[model samples]
Target: MKRIAIDMDEVMADFTKKHLALFNADYNEAITLEDLQGKKLRDLRPHLVDEIREYLKDPTYFRDLDVMKDAQEVIKELSESFEIYIATAAMHFPSSFTAKYEWLQEHFPFLDDQHFVFCGDKSVIKADYLIDDNVYQLERFTGEGILFTAPHNIHEDRFIRVNSWANVRDYFLK
Candidate 1:
């Protein structure tokens, strides 16, 4: 079976939406998704870098994230045919490791601890496929890469794009 490395952030988890909500609440301002388009949170608001980092330290930051639409359904189906592993970048925030672990247990109970690979860089991961929202990670990956669309990566065109989990299912079907 082909091994597939999936990313947890924007690919399966609604990371951008959660970050936007956190940013708005911390600043007490109305910031629309358009405001964060094509840029990361820290890059969009450099002044709030400390605040963003502070939030990352919070236990609920990663644990309370909303799962992406259809992610569970598509992943569950994919796992039946492929060896699935969740390779997420969680080393930056010390609290993220445990929080993400707990989050996965709560949301994706089917995935066990052995299926997780939490690291600072994703280049070390080896698999037949890597589905991630970050182009940087894909650039370093030695396998076939599928770009899971996020607002920040909409303009990227180097890899195959899967805009939704339904699209992901279709892409893999081929």
Candidate 2:
């Protein structure tokens, strides 16, 4: 069976939504997804960039993120045919290790703990395919890279793109 490495944040988890909610609530700003099209949060609101970094460092930040729509269902279905792995870059934030692991356990209990990879670089992941929101990770991957569309990567066109979990199902399961 072919292995598929799936990204956690912005792909399997609703990182953008939670990040925006926290930032908007604290800064009294109304930054919508439309405002972030083709741009990162830090790029869109450079003034509040520091606060954004601080948010990722918080222990509850990754732990409290909601699962991406249809992600659990589609990924569960895909697991029947493809080898599924959750590949997350957790080293970026030392505090996120436990939070991310716990979040995965809570939201994706069907996945085996051994399949979870918490690392700094995604290029080291050995899989036949990689579904990630960041093009940088995909760029370095040795296998097929499918861009899981996020507000920041809406305009990126270098790799195949899947706008939703349903799209992901169609791409692989169909």
Candidate 3:
């Protein structure tokens, strides 16, 4: 059976939504999703880059992130045809390891714990496919990389893009 390595942040989990909500509340700014199209939070507000990084350092940040729309349903369906694995770059923020794992357990209980890959680099991943929002990570991957659309990668057209879970299903299931 073919294996599919999936990204955790911004792909299966709504990292941007939670991050923006916290940043907006703390900074007293109202930045909408439309404002973030084709750019990252840091790129949009360079002065607040440090503040944004602080949010990521908070251990609770990843604990309650909303699951991406239809991600659970679509991944469950995909699991029937592919070996599913959740690959996350947890080394960037060590505090997020436990929270991310717990978040995955809560939102994606159907996935086995052993399939989780927490590392600093994605190039080490060996799978038939990798679905991620980061273009840099995809560039090094040996298999086909499906870009899971995110604000930061909105303009990137180097890889096959899936705008939503529905698009993912359409691409793989039908």
Clashing pairs in 2: none
Candidate 3: 10-residue stretch with minimal lDDT? 149-158
Q: Root-mean-square deviation of each candidate, in angstroms?
A: 1.3, 0.8, 0.8
Can you tell me which runs of candidate 3 are displaced by over 4 Å? none
Clashes of each: 0, 0, 0
**Higher-lDDT candidate among 1 and 2?**
2
Question: Which lDDT tens digits does candidate 2 get at residues 15-110?
Answer: 999889988999899999999999998997888788889999988889988889999999999999999998998888988999999999999999
lDDT at position 25, candidate 3:
93
Instruction: Give the alpha carbon lDDT tens digit for every residue of 1-99 in model 1.
Output: 999999998988888787778778868877777776777778877887888778778877888889999999989989889999999988878778888
**With candidate 3 superimposed using the best TM-score fit, by how many Å does residue 166's alpha carbon deviate from the native?**
0.8
Clashing pairs in 1: none
Top of the candidates by lDDT: 3
TM-score for each of the candidates: 0.94, 0.98, 0.98
38, model 3: CA deviation in Å? Answer: 1.1
lDDT of 2: 0.92
